[model samples]
Target: MDSKIPQIIRKSFIKEIIKKHSNIKVQSGVIDLLSECTTVSVSYISTICNAICNRKGKKAIGDEEVIEVLSKMDNEFILNMFEELRK
Candidate 1:
């Protein structure tokens, strides 16, 4: 969403999600999942990133915020589990 967040990072995030959740195939679903997990509206996510990039000149969501959101959804552990699954 953030214009400064390179397309590659967004793509990578989507790819990682798909790789971790094989059953989630739709891009929209991925968006929904992110929204649900973060308790942030998908539109807000898009808007916030855009604002941050355009107005504040930030590249991506800060790691601390990212970690906090992931922690709320217990997704940090899932990411670790996925790492094991990958191996």
Candidate 2:
């Protein structure tokens, strides 16, 4: 499906979503809404954890793992991610 945010923008948006909503419950809710709003469940919260885990170089990742990856993302990426939301 087409995305509201292009692929180039999406990478950073994913990073932004992950970082902004570190708490699992909050993150899950945000992801759900964003997925609904954008029609982008392919980027949903559970999809992220599963995708990360399914990566060749990556091991299984749980909620904490997801949080860690999201937390370590750069602030600049996050800022851009938020900025796009205003658009």
Model 2's lDDT to the true fold? 0.56
The C-alpha local distance difference test score for the whole of candidate 1 amounts to: 0.57
Candidate 1 is scored at a TM of 0.26
User: For residues 5-35, could you state the per-residue lDDT of candidate 2 as single tens digits?
Assistant: 5653654576586778775544555555564
Residue lDDT tens for model 1, 1-87: 676464446556767867797875667666556645544444554555555555656777654444444455566775576557657
Local error of candidate 2 at 40, Å? 7.9
lDDT of 1 at 6: 49
- How much does each candidate deviate from the true structure in C-alpha RMSD? 8.9, 13.9
Off by over 4 Å in 1: 6-8, 32-87
Query: Model 1 residue 16 lDDT?
Result: 80
